[model samples]
Target chain A: MIKTKIWVIVISLILTVSAALSVIIFTLPKKNVVAIYSDGELLREIDLSEVAEPYTFKVEHGDGFNEILVERGRIRVSFADCPDRCCVNYGWYYGGASPVVCIPHKLVIKAVNSQKDDFDVVTG
Target chain B: MKTKRIALDAVLTALALSVFIIEQQIPLPIPVPGVKLGLSNVVTLFALFAVSPLDALLILSLRIGIGNVFAGSVTGLIFSAAGGLLCYVTELILYKFLTDRQIWVCGVFGAIAHGVGQIFAAVGVSATAEIFIYLPVLILCGIVTGALTGSLAQVSVIKLKKVFPFLPFRRKKEEKQN
Candidate 1:
């Protein structure tokens, strides 16, 4: 049986590492330009600054579809066929940090500088 | 072979699913997605300690399946399936080394594994590295929630073992004493 002391150490270690990682992630500079991605390909680039009217569109994959709503300076997944609408929950992405991700639809909507492009995709 | 085992699995599945459904009704104070009490995990931990691995697996899948039907979208099922499997496997592996008192450790492991697994699935399906930015947030949430659930499971394991001496957690020697 694993000792309580060992677990205590493990827990403390995890807590420390998580805290450090969070700090690093939060401190990173927030960028501009909301990019809509499907299956790792850059489907559309929406310049948040140039948006005149909000619009809705669908990103269709082999399995299902996600209806995305783009506003003046943000983006959101309005509807989805996947069981969990995580992307939808992403709400209005004003871009402090973090992107809205939909696993089933293979979608990621994030605010990054127009030049910051390169996605690390893991294959099944 | 025993009717009791079947009944137990069914009950556990129901319990986990209800916990899942109820959790959704409660408003999330945190705006971020995928953060919750994860109460159903307590039941899974209980089953892992009280029953066999296969039994625990059965309860887990049933909970995920029913949970998806009642409260989740298909996309959620995919993420949960990936995350939940990782959580179970982490706990199952840790079971061998952990003393009964250290079950919470398993909880922490399961929590981190869940985050990592979901991230992997998200990255795979989306085929983009951009989602990686959410990793730190997810991992931090995992540590907090895992500790809470792990501690709860630890308490249940300690008390339940006495009430049901037939549970797999009992050692052959301890069984004789009881």
Candidate 2:
């Protein structure tokens, strides 16, 4: 039988590695260009740094919709028809490794470092 | 004997479902989806080690199916099913290798597998690989929460056997020797 000590060591090692990786992910540099995707399609891209005024718009998907609020240097899901409202609870996205996700609607908003000339190529 | 087993399974299923629903009420500090204490897994772990794998599987499946319908979203079912299935499979395999003392190890590995399964499901439904950014955090959360639930199960397995000796709970090495 496998000793308990070995199990402890292995679990500890994984815990440390994942903890370090999480730190790296959370501390990564923030990007300014944000792309919004729905059903794997690029619906819109906005340069957060260039926004002169705050605006809100609704992205409808089937029977539900996500109200997106874009501000000067950040973006957020102001509201959503999805039951979980996890995307809305995500508060604000200022550009990080993690994307603002709405799983029910198959929507994702992620920050990109560089602007792509052709959206189709990026999705492809 | 068969009737007793069925009654036990029903009781365990109800216990798991209650825990699952109550856990949903405990709002998490982290708003990121799929991150929670997963306290209901304690029942699954206990059932796996103390009862039987088949009973554990039945309890887990029923809890996920009905629990989601009660407190989760329609799309949320996909994530729950994927994660729960992977977690149960991992624990089932680990059960053969681990002594009763090491049930927590099963919890750790099973929790990690659950996180991975959730990520796969999220990627498929969203059709965006970018959602994978949550992987590391999810794994880290899994390990911490898994250990807690695992230890609780271990305790229950040890203590409950004496309380309900009629149940076919496995005895620890020391208890077997005694």
lDDT of each: 0.78, 0.85
Off by over 4 Å in 1: A34-124, B166-178
lDDT score for residue A108 of model 2 = 98
lDDT of 2 at B98: 84
Alpha-carbon deviation at B20 in model 2, angstroms: 0.8
Query: Which residue pairs show collisions in model 2?
Result: none
**Model 2, runs deviating above 4 Å:** A30-124, B170-178
Tens digits of lDDT, candidate 2, B49-168: 988898899999999999999975977788889999999999999988787777778888888888888999999997978778889899999999899888888888878887899976
| Best of the candidates, TM-score | 2
Candidate 1 structure quality by residue, lDDT tens digits, A5-85: 767887788788878987887776544588789999999888775677999999998879999888776778899989888
Q: Which consecutive 10 residues in model 1 chain B have the weakest lDDT in total?
A: B169-178
What tens-digit string does per-residue lDDT give for candidate 1 at B1-178? 4777788788889899999889878776754456666778898988887676788899999988889887648878888899999999999998887765666778888888888888888888779777777777777788888888988987887788788777445342232111
Q: Lowest summed-lDDT stretch of 10 residues in model 2 chain B?
A: B169-178
